[model samples]
Target: MFYWFLKWVALGPLLRVVFRPQAEGLENIPTDGPAILASNHLSYADWLFMPLTLPRRVSFVAKAEYFTAPGLKGWFQKTFFSGSGQIPIDRSGANAAEGALISAKGVLGKGELFGIYPEGTRSHDGRLYRGKTGVARLALETGVPVIPVAVVGTDVVAPPGKKFGKVTRPQVRFGKPLDFSRYEGLENDRYILRSVTDEIMYEIMTLSGQEYVDMYATRAKAEAKQAEREAAAEKKAS
Candidate 1:
């Protein structure tokens, strides 16, 4: 209800006019079935442009903080996120991964589309990071095909640490669905999970054309921040 209203009536139209997003290979997404949209996280705009371009509603598992902040700002945040077809899951605890999978599976159970960032977080640099195995686990466990999605130019439109971006069109390319049903029941096998995840990441890398980094996005961000802090401290002592 709110999702439809927000998308068709409010944000979707506004975003289309602003960014002019275009999607390719949208036919690959099943109009009525479960599938995982495995994408490389670039910017916050990645989420917006995806749903704005797709006809069917796509649901993303977002951080719980987006739904639990305080004050009027929190109310707006909660309303926007909820209305945009996002589900909140606490990602701070050790069991966060498990909880997210459960939430995602529930969405799949209803034969709906679910979106996931295989890198687990937005890429701090413009490189494709090694994907986490959660996506593979979800695909294998549910026996659903995984569609590799490449979202381009969103970083330029809405780069990290910025509230607004320049007026530029973004491109969304969808690859064919990847079937890993042959590896069914092997979701618990760590090696198999890594292999499956790497395969999906390979497709996303090909589509996005980002340099493949063999590290997680979160780790890369931390390292970049540390380097910045060290450089600042060194300059201060000079």
Candidate 2:
């Protein structure tokens, strides 16, 4: 399959040579069952580094745009993303979360590892942001244990707005699997979902050791952009 070919034959080897990614707690990942690997989003390289050392195939949901790019460059992009174990799903519209959940559930149903960023988007700053509750819903609905994963130093490998950077080592740490079996039937409860999601984020925070931000990463980015615009307007007026 393309996944194995890309992982073992191409990208995986290249990444090992370039980034020299290191991993700890590999034993925490279930060897032969469905499990959710929930991680903090640091940079685009976060996903790449997480699976570099893992033997089992891991699939992550990517935006639809990555698969729909046109022309030759688009073709390359699509091929690379697909071969890298990314499943494209439209993350827009009212049903975005539902659609993503459905797609992720299918991957898990196949008894494969499903990776998700509970923060929803990459952090503009280095701090960890509040996680969305969708991860909790997925774990509860599928009855899969959530493994808190922390990817460190990837931001240096590929920072935001830059295509690539100098080769640097990044580390991946996997925390123990979290079981929410006691709240099996409470998936529909918003309060319960928030509680479960917060707990997972807490573990990720402890593992990653990044400053905790109560606000979501998307909102923080928007606010930072707004501030930049305001500063530019004031400078132009002066």
Candidate 3:
């Protein structure tokens, strides 16, 4: 109810008018059954822009921090994120990835659309990072087709470190679903998981046309923050 209200009543119409999103291959999404929408993470706006174009209700796993924020800001974050059909996953420690996989599988088992940013985190430099194998593991475990989606121009709408920005048009493209039924029983094979994840990432790369980076986005973000800190210290000394 809340999801529809927001999509049809509030944010959807406004975003469409502003972003003028160009969506493609939406038919590739199955009307029924479980499927994973695997996409490249470009910016924070990628979360809102991708789903805004989709006709069906798609749920994505979000960081737990968004739900646990303090004060009125926390209340707003919780309401907004929860109403948008996002599931909160604690992204910490060795068990975090496994926990996310469990939650994704639960969603898929219920025959719902599961959206995952295979890169694990938003790209700091607009380059598609190597995908973690959790996506592949989910697909293999659930026997669901993985749809490759690309979101363009969202980085401009909301760049990293900026609370808000001038409203700009963004585009979203969905690629044909990739079926890995051939590897139905190979979910436990690490080599197979790696191969499948690479293939999915390749399709996303083609759709988004972003440069591929082999490193994870989280690592890149840490490095970027370190650089900013060092620069600030240098400026202070000077």
Candidate 4:
């Protein structure tokens, strides 16, 4: 109820007026079934714009902090996120990955669309990174079609580490659903998982036209920060 109100009456219309989100390949999404939406993570605004283009609600597993923060501002934050179809999960400690998988399974079990960022984290430089195998594992376990999604220009609307950026029209494109039924029983095989993940990333790359980086986004960010630190140290020594 609140989701519909917030989407149709409150926030969706406002965003449509502001960013003017565009979409392509709308027919790729299943009208009434469970499917995993594997997307490239470019910016925080990806979720907002991607779902705005769909008639169905897309649910994502968000960090528990967004729902548990204290005080009035936190209330608004929680309400807004909840109304936007985000499910809260504690993304801390070793069980974080397992927890997200379970939550996603629950959503899919309900025949709802589950959105996942296969890159694990947002790209620091707008280049599509190698996808983590969790998405492949989930698809294999659930036996659902995996849709490759590319959300472009969201970084312009809301770049990493920032709440807002330049105003530009963001475009969301959906590629055809990928079926990995051939590897149905081999979900436990790491090789199969990697192969499936790579295939999904390739589709996303083709759609978004971003340069492909074989490295994971998290590793790339760490290396970038390390290089910055080394440069600073060398400057100090000089």
Candidate 5:
């Protein structure tokens, strides 16, 4: 399949030589069967470099834009993203979050690795943001173990809102698989969902060593922008 081709034959080897990515706790990933890889959202490259270290294919949901571009370049991009295990999801709808969970659950049901960012969005700053509870729901609904993974230094490889940056090596760390079976059949309980999500975030915090911010990244960004506007208005009045 194209996934294996990219992972082992061409792209993987070239990336290994270029980035020289380092990985730890590889033993935590199951050699076979289904598992949820709940990781912190550092940068777009987090998906790339993390999966580069794994022998099994890890699929992540991506915006449909990546596959909808036109022209020859778009064709190549579509092929590459598709081959690299990025599934296109229509994230424009109100039920986008629920849809993503369904897509992830399908992958897990197939006994394949499904990667998700618990933070929902890439952190605007380098610090780790509070994770969304959808990951916990997926884990509970699918009965798959959640592995807290940290892809450090990827923000440098490709910053959140910019093009590729420096060529520094990115480190991928994997924590022990977290079992949440005790909370079985409680997926609908919002309180239980938050608790499980927090536990996963804690493990990611340890692995990533980034400052923990209790606010969601989107809200923080919005608030910061509002503050900036207020400051500008005050300056203008002066």
Candidate 6:
């Protein structure tokens, strides 16, 4: 009820008008039952644009920081994310991966559409990074078909810290459902998990047309921050 209300009454119309997203292969999404919507993370706008285009309620696993923000901005973030049915996951420590898997399994068990960005974090350089194997684990464990989705042009809408930029149209492409049921009962097999994750990433790459990186997005983000700090120190010394 609140989901539809928020979509049609508040967010849906506004986003459609602003982003002017072009979606394809939406029919690939099953009308009912559980499925995983795996996508590549490009920008913060990817969160807004991707869910808005989906006809069904797709719940994503968002970081816990979004829920703990302060002041009015924090309130809005918490409210919007909550209303959108996003699950909050604490991405800290060695247990974080296990915790996320538990949350995802719960969502899938309830016959819901679970949305996940296998890259673990947004791509700072607009290039698709190697996907984490969590997605494959979820699909293999839950026996849910994975739908590869791609969102293009969101990087232009809101890239990194620069928000409220020029309004550029976005495009979302949903690929056919991928079944990894053949690898059933093989969740413990690391080789199978990597193979499945790579296959899904390949499909996302085809849809988004971004260069694939062998490294993880988290690593790339760390490198970017280090470079920024070094540059700042150099300027200070000069």
After TM-score superposition, the amount by which residue 81's alpha carbon in candidate 1 deviates from its true location, in angstroms, is 1.4
- Give lDDT tens digits, candidate 4, residues 1-238: 9999999999899999998999999999989999999999999888889999999999998999999999999999999999889999897879999999999999999999999999999999999999999999999999999999999999988988899999999999999999999998999999999999999999999999999999989999999999999999999999
Model 1 lDDT per residue over 1-238, tens place: 9989999998788888877899999999898999999999999889999878888989999999999999999999999999888999998899999999999999999999999999998887789999999999999999999999999999998788887778899999999999998998898999999999999999999998999999988899999999999999999999
Query: How close is every model to the real structure, measured as TM-score?
Result: 0.96, 0.96, 0.91, 0.97, 0.95, 0.92
What is candidate 5's lDDT per residue for 1-238, written digit by digit as tens? Answer: 9889888899889989999999999999999999999898878888889999998999999998899999999999999999998888889999988888888988998999999998888987899999999999999998899999998889998986788889999999999999999999999999999999999999999999999999998999899889999999999999
Query: What is the Å distance of residue 203 in model 6 from its true position?
Result: 0.6
Q: Return whichever of 1 and 6 wins on lDDT.
A: 1
Task: Write model 6 residue lDDT over 117-214, tens digit each, in one string.
Answer: 99988888899999999999999998999999999988888886787667888898999999999999999999999999999999999999999999
Model 2 per-residue lDDT tens digits across residues 180-234? 9999999999999999999999999999999999998999999999999999999
List candidate 6 segments past 4 Å from native: 68-76, 231-238
RMSD of every prediction:
1.2, 1.1, 2.1, 1.0, 1.5, 2.0
lDDT of 2 at 221: 98
Q: For candidate 4, what's the RMSD?
A: 1.0
Query: How do the candidates rank by TM-score, highest first?
Result: 4, 2, 1, 5, 6, 3
How good is model 3 by TM-score?
A: 0.91
How many Å off is the CA of 213 in candidate 1?
0.5
Question: Which residue pairs come into collision in candidate 1?
Answer: none
Clashes of 6: 0
Cα miss at 181, model 5 (Å)? 0.7
For model 2, what is the error of residue 206's alpha carbon versus the real structure, in angstroms, after optimal superposition? 0.4
Worst 10 residues of 4 by lDDT: 89-98
> What would the C-alpha RMSD of candidate 5 be, to one decimal place?
1.5
Give candidate 2's whole-model lDDT. Answer: 0.93
